[model samples]
Target: MTHTAALALASGLGFGLSLIIAIGAQNAFLLRQGLLREHVLPVVAVCSVSDVILIAAGVGGLGSLLDAAPWLVDVMRIGGAVFLLVYAALAARRALRPSAMAAEEARSGTSLWPVVTTAMALTWLNPHVYLDTLVLLGSVAATHGDDRWWFGAGAMTGSIVWFTALGYGARLLRPVFARPVAWRVLDALIAVVMVAIAATLLHGL
Candidate 1:
């Protein structure tokens, strides 16, 4: 690889990871799913694949299409806010009823379909994903000229690696989350984060 391409790749990896590592609605949901050991593979697959598609679209200059239609973002923002509010309500309910937070009880109740659907919603419904992957990453990738694809490949690598680590590594926290109180605290925090993101989305709209 040319030095310039290598630099672009490295820059993409760093920038992508930095954006994704933030604690947001998607990450919070993924962390919860990881802790529950529920549909982890599916959840990770959906998120990673979604990121790749979005990144590809961005790198391919689909951001221009979005730019031409500003109303699309507004629609997504409103829809995302509603979805987040509903999720926050569910989390708050779980936090209030500690009995529901029991590890074993939480594990067997949810079907794979719902978990997968929720993962997809948490991912695709969020307007910020487009802003980050499409607008921000796309704009940066543009700086690489012909090496933009390589930059995208690097960014895609970051997403896959991060999600795999987050989903699998969450098992290490199993011992800690074994306590019902831990689940309660985690759900409460998730609730707060979800609500805050929803509020931010609404405010933006």
Candidate 2:
């Protein structure tokens, strides 16, 4: 590979990982799923594949298309905020109810379909996904000139690696999460993060 291509790939990997490593709605949900060991593979697949598609679209100039239609962002903002708020309420309820604080009890009742749906919603519904993957990453990829595809490839690789690591690696924490109090604390924190993100989205609109 040419130096430019290598540089672009490295840059893309760094930027992509940086954006994803933060504690956001999607990451929080993924972490929770990972901790519960419920539908981890499918959830990780959805998030990684969604990132691949979005990064490809951005590299193909879909960011430009989105820029032309500001209303699309507005719609996403509203939808994402509503979804986040609902999730926040659910988390808060779980946190407050001592009976629901056990991870095993919670896992027994959750179906695969709801988890899959929530994974998709958390990934695609958020407007920040578009801004980060489409606009920010796309703009950076453009700097690579003809090697933009390589940059995107790097970003996609980062996404896959990060999601895989996060989902599977969370099992290592299972012992810590075995306690009811740990689950309660986790749910409470998730609630705070979700509500904060929802508020940010609503304020943006």
Candidate 3:
């Protein structure tokens, strides 16, 4: 690999990580799933694959498409805000019921389809994901001359690495989340973060 290409790859990695490594609805959901050791692989796969698709689209000129239809962003933004707010309410309700937070029962009883659906919604429904992976990252990738694909590859790699680590590494915190109070706190935090993000999205719109 050329040194310049390597540099572009590194830059893309940094950019991707910086944008995603945040306290958001998707990360909160993934963390919860990880703690329960429930549907972790599917959730991670959904998120990672979604990012790969978004990044690829962006690099392949989704930016131009987006610009041609600015209302698309607004539609996504509204849809995302509604989903986040609804999820936040659900999380807050969970926080209120420590007994229902039954990690064991919840994990065993929950089916794969619901988790997969939520993961997809949290990923694809979030307008920020579109803006971040499509507009911002796409624009940046275009600036990399002949090495833009390398940059896109780096971003894709970053998404995979971060999601894999977050999903699997959360097991290390299992001991902590084993306590009902810990679950309550985590749920409360998730609720707050979701609402905050939703508010920001609405405010921007």
On lDDT, the candidate that comes out on top is 2
Q: What is the full ranking by lDDT, best candidate first? A: 2, 1, 3
How many clashes in each candidate?
A: 0, 0, 0
- Cα lDDT tens digits, model 1, 1-205, are 9998898888888888998999998888888888878888999999999999999998998888778999999999999999999989888888998765555355645578888888899999999999998998999999899999989988999999999899888889999987878888888999999999999989997
- Summing lDDT over every window of 10 consecutive residues in candidate 1, give the lowest-scoring window: 100-109
For candidate 3, lDDT tens digit of each residue in 1-205? 9998999999989998988898788888898889888889999999899999999998887878778988988888899999999988888887897655565346645588888998999988888898888899999999998999999999999999999999999999999876778888998999999899898889987
Q: Quote model 1's TM-score.
A: 0.95
lDDT of 2 by residue, 46-101 (tens): 99999999999988888997789999999999999999999998888889997655
Q: What's each prediction's TM-score? A: 0.95, 0.95, 0.95
Give per-residue lDDT, candidate 1, residue 161: 92
| Residue runs of model 2 more than 4 Å from their true location after superposition | 101-110
Task: Check candidate 2 and list the clashing pairs.
Answer: none
Instruction: Please estimate how well model 1 matches the true structure, expressed as its whole-model Cα lDDT.
Output: 0.89
What lDDT is reached at residue 136 by model 3?
A: 95
